[model samples]
Target: MTRASYVRRTSEIEHYFDRTALAAWKRLTGDQPVSGIRATVRQGREAMRQTLAGWLPRDLTGWRILDAGCGSGVLSLELMARGADVVGIDLSAQMVSFARQRAAELQTQRSVPTAGRVDFRSGDMLDPRLGRFDAVVAMDVLIHYAPEDARSVLEQFAERTRRGLLFTLAPSSHLLRAMLMIGKVFPRSDRAPAIYPTDPEQLAGQLVAQQHMSGWRVGRSQRISVGFYTSQAVEVVRS
Candidate 1:
């Protein structure tokens, strides 16, 4: 494999986390505002929320949910508030810090003054330290690896999941590719170097090959004036 395809180290992801957090916070709160990044964050958040809404149960009480590569813990925090036991892991230390801080802020804002049911960890998705989760969601991630490595990562995700999986990828259409290209050219985008453009079909095939799921269902929503598609896959495992 080329050096570009090598898995990015935690330090690299941490730097990424630091960059995106500043942008996301500025966009979300708008107290410290950037018109451009705010637009990007709004789009991304909408895409992520649409993806999460597709796979998540109407109520997740007492369920175990894992957010892999969970930057800023957006879905993780939401699931915890719904009474799921949530665990968020990221290779980026900065992301873990941001998630923890966000969780704290959320706890303070609630009328019940309750804490979130989330545990944040700094670790690679491939590491065994993560144990297992009932459902795992990794959004806007996995595109950083080469196609082969991406398949391996999906296999790893399958091993850890007891119920379902949800994830996002760049859309397969030519229009969507052009849109992503334009977005990448935006100032300070900090795009992942090895991000090979892969669509839901390719990813679904990979998961099926690993027996992670019998098949995958594709869905999408628009964000940031772009189309973001999600792949939802389910595997039946015998107890």
Candidate 2:
């Protein structure tokens, strides 16, 4: 994708999460009760987060991790509990605010001994000012981008990621296409930003072929599917 298109999409996503869907997202990520469909989505997200966590070292002491697109800081908190010093960045200011509040609450209530900490910020995840990380975890962050844009974003991440990059993408499938069609029926104002489903095999092939990603190799992967949520987790490790 062209830089202008990428920027436009990014801005759209920021507006959706930061303004249009902020309240609903806060509830979904919190302990509040939601509808059955949202319940399944919540469950699926939790499972996916656990799956990503499992891919990391059991003990993350001294690790410097980046939680890209950290919504309300659930994954960031989990990583912190595992002894990782995490930097959680998101495009939504409201989301980052919520994350900071949540983190503060957790730290006040818990006395567990761990080497984990988190600095939540609202900004572009690809910002160079954020500096390098031992690893980066971006859950459901790239699903809005076209395939080529997604790969380009990954290549950018690869440059600063010393060890590995873990992220989720909307997988291309019949069910996913059907879901997209169904989503189109909703009013544009009521619907979330469009999700671009990407073929995992094609994405892997592109990663392998990209000269910029030559130092990295595709690693483990898994797909998580629930009533309304389906995402593929992919790992890329430095060679």
Weakest 10 consecutive residues, lDDT, candidate 1? 230-239
lDDT per residue (tens digit) for residues 46-83 in model 2: 99999999999989998999999999999998899889
Worst 10 residues of 2 by lDDT: 106-115
Which residue pairs collide, candidate 2?
Answer: none
Give the Å shift of residue 104 in candidate 2.
0.6
For model 1 the TM-score comes to 0.73
Model 2 has an lDDT value of 0.89
lDDT of 1 by residue, 1-239 (tens): 33344454344555665665556553463234445655555566665665565557767786887788876777777777677788888877766777788777767887322333788987776677778787777766665555566666666776777776666554445764576577677564455432446655656655665544554333333322332333223222223
